[model samples]
Target: MKGYLKAHTHFFLPSEQMAEYLDLPEKTSYSALPPAGDSNQVLPLPDSALTLFYVGGIGAHYKLNAFIDAARSIPQIRVNLVTRKKQWDEAIASYPTFQSPQIHPYHLNANELDDLYAQSHIGVLAVEPSDYRRFAVPLKLFEYLSRGRPILVTEGTEAARIVSSFNAGWVVPYTAEAIAATLRRLQGNRAEVQAKAANAVSAAKVNTWADRARTVADTLTGKSK
Candidate 1:
């Protein structure tokens, strides 16, 4: 099979791997996880000691409702929803865990959203088999990596393989029981959680977007051909 005419390298590499295990040339890369902050840096997270972020489109297809439901079963797990304003109220109202105080649903602006990534311990991604999700790696995937947080991804797709292969985090089936169980295990073992987080960050340090882009550029420019 050949590459899609309109596809970017990010889409191409993953799709190629998924479809036929094509051996794309490996390239050196790095992540932009923030460096040690100075005195001027102000962390804007709430007072909650443990916060978790779940990002997805506000539409019905993203399956964020399932994530919020799972989060409610876990104690002290602040479920901050990162989404646009138009979909925020509807999402809140439709969410199965609507009234739970532990479920803090916020519609963050771009910068505020980035702050959420910076402050959270785990990053959850909800991507289903829909047109919007196909062949695209959500920014949250890399953002979580860059933040050095352990990621909890719903498995059986490309996202799961990426996390599992890199030793970045846990990949479970898209079920409340599965998600709840994974979070519980992480909560039970703080040392294990921290170790996974460190491993993810270390992996991110090498998988930089700049480097991914350059390799893609080479592939497209005949450097790989």
Candidate 2:
């Protein structure tokens, strides 16, 4: 049987590596998000909004604290961060900007999350490198990609490869200073950032879950087995 996990390739094992273990003859690449909003219609973006989303664990390894610190440097841009439960209250206490209405953390539904994705400019991935993450990719990365927003990847290991391959976003050092600098750059050049968003959306069209389904079928149907 094949283990197919969509939208987790940012930090996971390369398809070639996984195929080796499964003794499978083929590998499939898929996105976690559905797809870009109908390509026929060009999605308009917020003029002065920069939304950064983080929707996962509350572990110490994920440096959400640092991402908030960096986000504070950009005044013109608004930061909307989403985390699990109430862990952010303490984290927010340390940063005065979180007290401001522009920078927020809250719970959202499926449609609400999609609305956020549609309106967001960047997605902040704050997970650090560990054994589990090294072999596993976060679904959020693919979700962010599906929306065609630039990614601010916090992990400095395998995830970097995907960013580099797609030229999706700026790679910051695993520190507050680097993250701050990258966010500033993104803020200064919103046009360039939007272009990266378009590029990401374009690339995603050719790489999708439907393609993965076909490959999975071929393997299980005894065509590739």
Candidate 3:
């Protein structure tokens, strides 16, 4: 560890805040895994009710309850909660409407997300506030954007910046009421959702994995393209 630290001249981190916290050196850059997805992976499902999905980590800090309560409140809106089976089961049981067929929970399978995303209209990015979290972006954010799904992110996440920049989705308060309200809005105004989905795919084109790789390679080789 000691020798490696000295031998390494540059550092590439995912989060700027993380790089600062480490305080390694001035020779630092950020390289997040920008996985670009094909919009064709998910086509509009011919469903009357608007569907939403959350695919990633799940726990208390994730504030998944807000998603649950919000989706539960709007019975017309459907949800797909994909996460680890144990954590998903444990967390979901805390809700009274855990048995609702409208709100489906799945044992996460990274390779099998296309169909799930295909059936959804929006992706939820719900995380509670924290010093570090405020400046850290989530990979799921990129996933949602890449797959042409508008997101429903909390008010204060750093990921919200990207959503705002691309006009990719709505950023609401981290509360069931707020999320429910937004879902209601989208349900009645699906054209708005379609517009945002288009924006998401446009954003994905500029921030794809190929883009990340080329940028990193160019930076490392001191080459200007």
Candidate 4:
């Protein structure tokens, strides 16, 4: 295909393994949107009861059941899953943990989703380990960072790397025990969580859509290459 095609562009730089597989050049131009909200807002204090917020697909790949299980051990921990009513119903019917008193499921509009983020303490991205995850950066991760919320993401994905690089969140294995342990760690270290929250906002400032757009414009105008 490389020999047959003239050129192509990537929304993001392919992983080293992927580049090697495709026999791509050593360097490639890349572009990505930054955080999607105001970055100047004051960071919220950690909630008294640890609140984990997840808003997205309720499919099996998300591994939200693990989070539900994790919440079971900590009665004070609250888990919120926001999705469409249909998906919510399917999730509750498929997973018993969805019925837990600590778990709350909601169907929210876009504005309400922002409100939900405001009320939450931590943003969660519990993707199951898979090959596709290596290249994908979930949008919710940026949304979480934009809202100045620290993240809890699974290891071995781009999201984990970003969180680690920015010191904006924790990366843990995709298991109930690991999740529960990390939750406890965050709960005991309120100051640490607050620090991470501040870092998230700082990170968002550098990765906003406006910045990405400027990069793209520069590239098109021969100002950058």
Q: Count the backbone clashes (under 3 Å) in each candidate.
A: 3, 1, 0, 1
Q: Once superposed on the true structure, which residue ranges of model 3 sit more than 4 Å away at CA?
A: 1-8, 26-47, 97-101
Better structure of 3 and 4 per TM-score: 3
- TM-score-based ranking: 3, 4, 1, 2
Write down the lDDT of every candidate, Cα atoms only: 0.62, 0.59, 0.75, 0.75
Q: Which of candidates 1 and 4 is the stronger one according to TM-score?
A: 4
Q: Write the per-residue lDDT of candidate 2 for residues 1-225, one digit (tens) a residue.
A: 233335323212343333344443334433222222223322446665566666665546565656666666667667776666566765555554556644666766545676666667776675555554444556666666666766777554445556667887666666768887877776677788888877667655554666555655675455754
Model 1 deviation from native, Cα RMSD in Å: 6.8
In model 4, residue pairs whose N, Cα or C atoms come closer than 3 Å (at least 3 residues apart or on different chains), thus clashing, are 34-207
TM-score of 2: 0.72
Q: By TM-score, who's the top model here?
A: 3
Evaluated at residue 169, the lDDT of candidate 4 is: 91
Q: lDDT value for candidate 4?
A: 0.75
| Residue 71 in model 4: lDDT | 82
Residue-wise lDDT of candidate 4 within 1-225, one digit each (tens)? Answer: 454333655434423334444565545534443334444543575456778898888866666777778888888888887888988888777876678788888888767775667678889887677777776677778778888888998899877887898998989998999989989888787888888888988888876777767766876676875
Candidate 2's C-alpha lDDT?
0.59
Candidate 2 stretches greater than 4 Å from native? 1-43, 90-102, 220-225
Error of 4 at 149 (Å): 0.5
